[model samples]
Target chain A: MPIPSPTVITAATLDLRGRPVFVRSTGTTDGPALILLHGLPTSSWLWRRCLPDLAEALPGWRIIAPDLPGYGRSAPRPGAGPRHLGGWLHALLTTLGVDRFALVGHDLGGLVALTDAVARTGRLGGTPHPARTGGPQLERLLLLNTTIYPAPLLVLGLLPSIVPPFADLSLVWLGRGGAARDDDRRKGYVVGMRQLLAPGTVVEAVEWAEYARPYGPIAGWREARRSLRALAWQAPFVLRCLAHLGDLTLPTRLIWSRHDPFFPLAVAERLRRAIPGAEPMIHIIEGAAHFPQEDQPAEVARLIAEFLREPR
Target chain B: MPTHTPVRYVLTSHVEEHGGRPAAATHAEIFEQVALADSFGFDALWLAEHHFGAQAGMVSQPLLVALAAATRTRRINVGTSLIVLPLHHPLMLAEQLSTLNLLTEGRLSIGFGSGSAPFEFAGFDAPFDGERRHPRFREALEVIERAWTGEPFSHEGTNFQIGEVRLVPRPTRPLREFAWLGAMSEQTAAMAGEFGYGLQLPRGQSADHYAAPIGAFRAALRDTWGPDAPERLAIARCVYVGTDDETAIAEAGPSIRRFYEHSKGYDKTKPTPAAPELIERLHFIVGGPEKCAREIAAFVAATGISHLSIQPIWEGLEHGQAIASLRRFGAEVMPRAEALIGAERAAGVAGQD
Candidate 1:
């Protein structure tokens, strides 16, 4: 059954221990809320294709997409990075009045959501608190193409800022997938992703005409850029937190694109070995590159539904 | 002087984020603010362009065009208060502005300014020599204007060296009749006169200070370009209007004073009474409609300002206060000033007859 037109509700940025954070909900309010966290350089618009199906099949599900502080629509917190992100997500979910529900995260969101599960466990006094024994007993931990050891990226920073500025540049070029590289198209990605820190396909949906509405000028984009760059430097702490994921007893599933240029299949295999009591099913999306959600939304959605239906 | 028809008040945006205003001030808020200004009868809105700041003030070309996208649904004329001419090659600026003009249905004003901010000039690696910047600005302006003429042209000047280039998506008008030279010095004012362009007074300067520049332009036009030169002059000032003196003084005085005081060469942090002088000057039109009318009249008497661009909003000023102030300027203050202009124009006609 086709779901009715989606309803979008924008929530004001809440003070999470003095951090500015916001949440946006699409679909029904009474449904089980799936807190969808996006990756670097994109917003909830990354999930545009999968949302309709999730909304249709899981009529009891409410899709909660929050731009993490320093990404998308959310304002940045004074201190935000991979290590502190899980706790922040926990606080954000609680503030939004969401209780126990399955958490589905992708890319950066997956790491954040799993970390948040541990933090939430501690908050709810669940067994094996990350600070105490570490990790949590989440209902289900869903992950997309994400890295296990965030260390290698940090060591690359040993190079001077000028030399390795092209490090991320190479990644971006790969992400472009050889689209017609005109000034508009090139600047669209740079200004949208690097400057605004909130660029996504939603720009295509809205038409680029008034896209400037969400972003006033380069100044706003630059501010977002500065904060994102600072966040990129916090990779050491992110690697330190890897030990905590091992303590997670939750049934976890990892979905990855076989040909992901950023996180190879080898990294996903390492993640499977690291996690405790991991689920048997791992979906390796073929042909799709970094974002299988965009390239293979239907197949990914089907796999997710199948995974969720398996008996505990 | 006020005109026969009521003067329409303009609120310039410049997409600028100041001390109190952060870069993250939302677009939803910006759009709503413009709409509020329009409903209250603001005649025009302007956005500025800038590349880098501790806070990125503005970040793109077609700055006016982007702002117009947010506001084209409304009635007010949308434009760049002044796009820095030195930073962009003329051909690029010409193409962007022309497309913007065509898109906005002639609801555009082409404002060209010599790059002012030292930081902006340095960021672009453009020459920061103030004496040389004006010539470059003028050269770029010549190229831009020629491209807008809808006729193929070529020009080589001190800074700009564009060869036979015709602008695409040309505007309906062969030339933008509303071209403005954003003049900060007497030399620039004279250049505007020599080039047959309208004069745009700098934002922070008082009307009294403008007297010399305006005079120099008129004198130069008469001496070299001949007295037959068409008069096209405009002035921009920071202004705030209220229902009464107490209300205006209480609401807008601090913010407006802080703005000018923060401006280079006029630091309020020093022990100076710049605010008091500004309030008393012909430049700032504050208070009730009648009082504002009087101030404008005094300004016209002091300097023959035909077009006035008044900034009625600052970062911390409440939206309601700005709306009330703009409404008063449009409905009451404008008519009184227009009547004054009508009287002056009539007197001139009588003298001719």
Candidate 2:
């Protein structure tokens, strides 16, 4: 039996903090909000498979997935650091008039969410920042395949420091198109994205094209390199915010990919122990590499729904 | 009389190396053998896991090797003959097995055992005490079964203090069907039956050694799951087929002796038997097609096993010779053995009438 394709995602651009931030959304706007944040090297397209299902599962809740400041169709913001990305999320939520919401973050987006949560709860070991004053009330937090400790980020972070241009250059080279056409460039980016999935996963051509579209041009690479450079530069501050993870008071849950080479189960284990209010076990998604959303979309959506529907 | 059951042939390997062969080459040969088994219509390929012993078996992670085999073959099922359960965290093992099952499209089977090597347990920093081992194994298996349910569960056991956790990518099928317990003792056999898992009888033991355990296993299954419950029993045997009995012994005799010599070095306390008595005790089935078939039929009828896992390759055996034995067994011995079992079953039914 053939499985039906996921529901089509609706995309639009919203002006947040003087920059054009692209958002992919579904469900009613007036309902309680559920914001999804994508990580590095990806945009709102990361949530394409899970968005509609999430919307269907929640029924009345608004599901909003936005590209990080410098990814996909969103215009890159100059001088934005890792912590600044968290501030950018607050600004995006305020601009969207989302006062109370649940947040789900993956990869680097998870770092951004943790930073924001820490800052909001005034746990950053300093005077509370202005972004914490009137931000959206975070009801539930979900983190997927992300790291709080600095050890896991050392490879990606230190590579740039050790060999200044080696990381981005290789990515750009591997992401180079065979031909001058835009479709060829998209296919080239698809090749790069293929490395992030579990072996033997059969992805559709159209879906691959959608995921690779944002990185199809030289401008996309420029934004991606900018994001990477910012992350590499702000590693210390990110670690500082992560250190305050024990201070987070929100109801948190971790859904991790078991085979994720970048952020292994050990990282999730640490994070689960760090968070005081975290659910006892780190829900492990098997048969997936870095991206569980792509490898097990229905399961991801179902887990999200199950978590969100739990009585507070 | 034993119940009539159709037989399944599985190619089992310890991935043993000899002749100063490199470990990489041994693995390459095993994969080639896996492809051969797949093409030759064998039911499954099972690999053994051994830690810190490259001579006995180089494969420390049999599930990874099974995953490699699963990817290479189209139809053959891949499995671990026994994964040392107590050495690994159950949640992690469950996740890995679940991943392998999904990647293979439900063609993954697993055999669990509380390992026999005290040194290996010490190496893993696990409790090697006999009293703690059984309880730890039971706790780990229980945790794994609950984790496969795709629902939030918690366990506060003697060995594990797990909080609310759920497994993802859920299970593709009922995991019990793919589970096997490697049992040598009557207690362990009863545990296997209680857990509703297939029972795998260990190799290198005589038929008399297995009789009590087999009886206990059947009784446990009948008492726990009812009389009509399905029984999946498997036994391993060292087999080699040549032109005839004399030639077979001449070719395999020295290699088999060397294999036992290497095994004896692992434990010096047990008295070592001479070559021929050791061969008889281990039940090495070496001969031409007709003789091998007759013995295999007799062994199957005696043990009432539905699956026959054959170890045709051993240390010091040439790869080509092992392949030839495999080809001959699949082509000649298997059919003849089936015919013999069928005749015996028919005669049993005739006697009953």
Q: Compared with the true structure, what per-residue lDDT tens digits does model 2 show for residues B37-90? A: 888677788888899984578889999889999999999989978899999999
lDDT of 2 at A100: 88
On residues A142-168, what C-alpha lDDT tens digit does candidate 1 reach at each position? 788766465434433332122222234
Where model 1 places Cα greater than 4 Å from the true spot, the runs are A1-312, B1-8, B15-43, B54-75, B151-158, B204-206, B219-230, B266-278, B281-283, B340-353
Task: Pick the DockQ winner.
Answer: 2
| Stretches > 4 Å off in candidate 2 | A1-312, B1-4, B265-277
Clashing pairs in 1: A31-A60, A32-A60, A130-A134, A218-B59, A219-B56, B2-B337, B3-B338, B14-B47, B14-B48
Worst 10 residues of 1 chain A by lDDT: A158-167
What DockQ class does candidate 1 belong to? incorrect
Write the residue-wise lDDT of candidate 1 on B1-353 in tens digits: 22344444566654444445544553344455567667756656665666664223543453644554444456666666577888888888778777766776766666678876877888888887977876677667667655664444555567867666657875555342556677768988887765556677766556678888899787755443335445667777666778887788778877666655555567545665545565664246678777788777666656676567776666456655776787777678777876776676678678878
lDDT of 2 at A56: 78
